[model samples]
Target: MSAAALLSPSAPLPYSGAITDVAGIEVGHHTDPRRPTGSTVVIARDGAVAGVDVRGAAPGTRETDLLAPGNFVQQVHAILLAGGSAWGLAAADGVVRWLEERGVGLDVRFGRLPIVPGAVLFDLPMGDARIRPDAASGYAACDAASTAAPAEGNVGAGAGALVGKLFGVPHAMKGGIGTASVKVGGVTVGALIACNPLGDVVHPDTGELLAGARTDDGTALRDTRRSLLRGDVPRPLLAGTNTTIGVIATDAVLTKVQAQRLATVAHDGLARAINPVHTMSDGDTLFTLATGRVPLGEEAPGMTVLSVMAAEVAAQAVVRAVLAARAVTTAELAIPAARDWPGRRAAA
Candidate 1:
């Protein structure tokens, strides 16, 4: 079916405004009740060609090397995104075991070994640092997988997410998970992001700041970009303590190399929406998965179109993440949501 046909007046499949709109994809989340931290899983039970790109300097990842074009593993059974800094990488272990039990993964000589590559963002500072997502968390998220639109904001890996932390956590705003999808030609490109950047989130088209570091009074936003441009020095943040991680999936036929390119170009979306992204303190990473449901005639031209759509959806997802977030208050500090910002509400 052509993209036009899918968007016709009588088209059957309606856009969900979530990554689950992509065919052959299932999303699940597990938000810890004990604390504001958790894990998320994206499953491709039938397997999908996958690729990855890590742009941030202090990434905490697992099995990303295998996604290289020259590597032997060309597909991934699932992708995991979790909170808890380096410890969150362990969440992938549970996903691998779950997939193995279901007979999903690369068929090895003795048994099936599920190929689950994952990344983690730092959320340890938000709540109880010691109570991070464990293996059980990954299993629960996988168990919750479904084709339905997943919940957004303050859930899963984004539960503890805080953005615009250039001044410090106390000045940051609540961040969360968001998803978006767009159809191009005959394929659908979707993105799911756990936004926890060290910088501010801006409207991609309007160049308006939606959320970010707040003024000393915590009543107004202190635009991070302009603050830096004014020679304002920010407090030193711990490396690997902040990051934004996400996945981009599409229902288009693409080679492993093409998938990697898509992931690379998709970073443009992050740049467009995030101020001072991919910084030393931010372990930003993105992955791409191709389900091969729709085939394009020419690889070059198709990739160009797909890449553009991928960036658009990624930027949209980032903006939605903060917009959907809710205010979080604790004894130590209080973080406001974008919607609660008086300036933003007034503009709206």
Candidate 2:
């Protein structure tokens, strides 16, 4: 059985240009078979702004000046979130190289290093098990970005991503890259995510889940109700082998502390959309960049409001990634069907 059966989207929905609302926030991706996993970055002009928030013990995040609030908050030059897990952390090195070549960064006491903020998820270990993200792969991941697509599913760090692993991979659904954005108080909030979680997702409005859990034959949805009420395995048979990563981008002004707070609030969005999120095993992390143009500062309630919107966008992106994923019949994991699936054409 797989998560393919238990969850679904309300209906197929396109991005509708929501992710691109942020000014100068350009996204790039690089995917290679040798690497399989890839990376995504939101690039801005030199000396823009940034900040971050760290929630997991095993996190591989980098260049977090973007999330901190202050005069420095608005100067995020770029952000990188990638899939090699901890090994993938090197992907940011390439971004550093790129920005260095282009002369984009801050010139504080640190002697003007390229300011590329980032976050990473634990996917390589699960996707290939034996494989870990390497410097060569990181270089390859970066070299291919010039022609990269926001290509959804089975690509980048999401290349081998799977979700709802309660019964293990057999019962999991394919999940990959997804992106979304929204406007609040004239500020554009965009979320780009790599969905690799170990729990089922709910619609939020109705208690009925849209996706997750398939039968043994891989044709029908399993009853999560029974799985819960029956307690087939005592203590909820959970393994902390999952994570969700993203950056919340806005043109509003914020400090690194406020940006970090923004990231904290943004986690609420992940929690609202993803069930059983930020768990012991999942190294869930979110980064927030002030972009430093607008004059928005840290206010808990205001941050909370933005966090709610971010959560909504993040959840939608996760669902979309699953929808865009194509079921693979590989020996490691095989999904029989898709839920709330989208953008796939049947093989001719």
Candidate 3:
């Protein structure tokens, strides 16, 4: 579908331009001041049917297995996305604690045990590796949760995100978080992505490079696909150092199995906007959450429609990520944002 068709609101209904447009969902972020790394949390206070799909080979996640269709757990209280690689997983503990304090989670014999699933991306290369998101960071994010549109770019899990590293860090651009939502009849679907892919971000409809590896002179986009086609091999990046993780949510009612299917098909959006997604060196993952507010039967046609909308919103969210990103420079390295790139300025 064309970008306009994918992004344009359906007739008679308008979108809130954020994932929080979905009822019963809230978003929050905690950016560490020590360096460019932080955490983002998506909370479903009353709990929502959830499913996850981990496409990258080197994924680092928590409680994902419990989200399986056959698993006894049917819902999740929150989903956490953070930067710090594996160590960032510790942040989920704080989310669990915050939810438990609020009496949210599956009731057991002793007390409520919140179910918080999460994924992480590597940003240690940007600055101080020692300073990463921890339990406190997660709690702070939850404390800041709000229904209003959360700030995008250079915050939350997207802080310190670097893209177009196929040629190495020096040739990369800054990446960040972005959110978008769309409405279809009574159903509304939204996506929030923290884009840090190993490949380039491109316009889904036009296929123009938005951000990626820069030329040797660092003055223009290198066009990763063309460079590879011309036999320009990429430098070896560390396994699990790159990823694009996000959450897709809707107010439509859906079964656990259907939610999983939605998560699977949503990867199409990633493929549309990201070149060479789900690579061995990347840990791409996506989660689906259904608020069960709108009644849409678990029939083939209803699922088909929701699936299409899911992918469209996901792709749009990816594009917004790079566009909203701002430049970030450390003492050791400087990464430009797509909006500030010389090629983009020259084109404008």
lDDT of 2: 0.61
Off by over 4 Å in 2: 1-13, 56-58, 63-75, 108-111, 125-132, 135-149, 223-229, 234-240, 295-304, 336-348
- State the C-alpha lDDT per candidate: 0.88, 0.61, 0.88
Candidate 3 regions off by >4 Å? 1-16, 297-301, 345-348
Clash list (residue pairs), candidate 3: none
lDDT of 3 by residue, 1-348 (tens): 433232222221123378898988999999999899999999999999999999998898999999999999999999999999999999999999999999998999799999999999999888889999999999999999999987787899999898889899998898899898988787889999999999999888888778888888887788887788889989987899999999999999888999999999999999999997899988999999999888874442388889998999899888888777788888889888876656641111
lDDT of 1: 0.88
Every model: Cα RMSD to truth: 5.5, 5.9, 4.2
Q: Number of clashes in every candidate structure?
A: 0, 42, 0
Model 2 TM-score, all chains together: 0.79
lDDT, residue 307, candidate 2: 64
Per-candidate TM equals 0.93, 0.79, 0.93
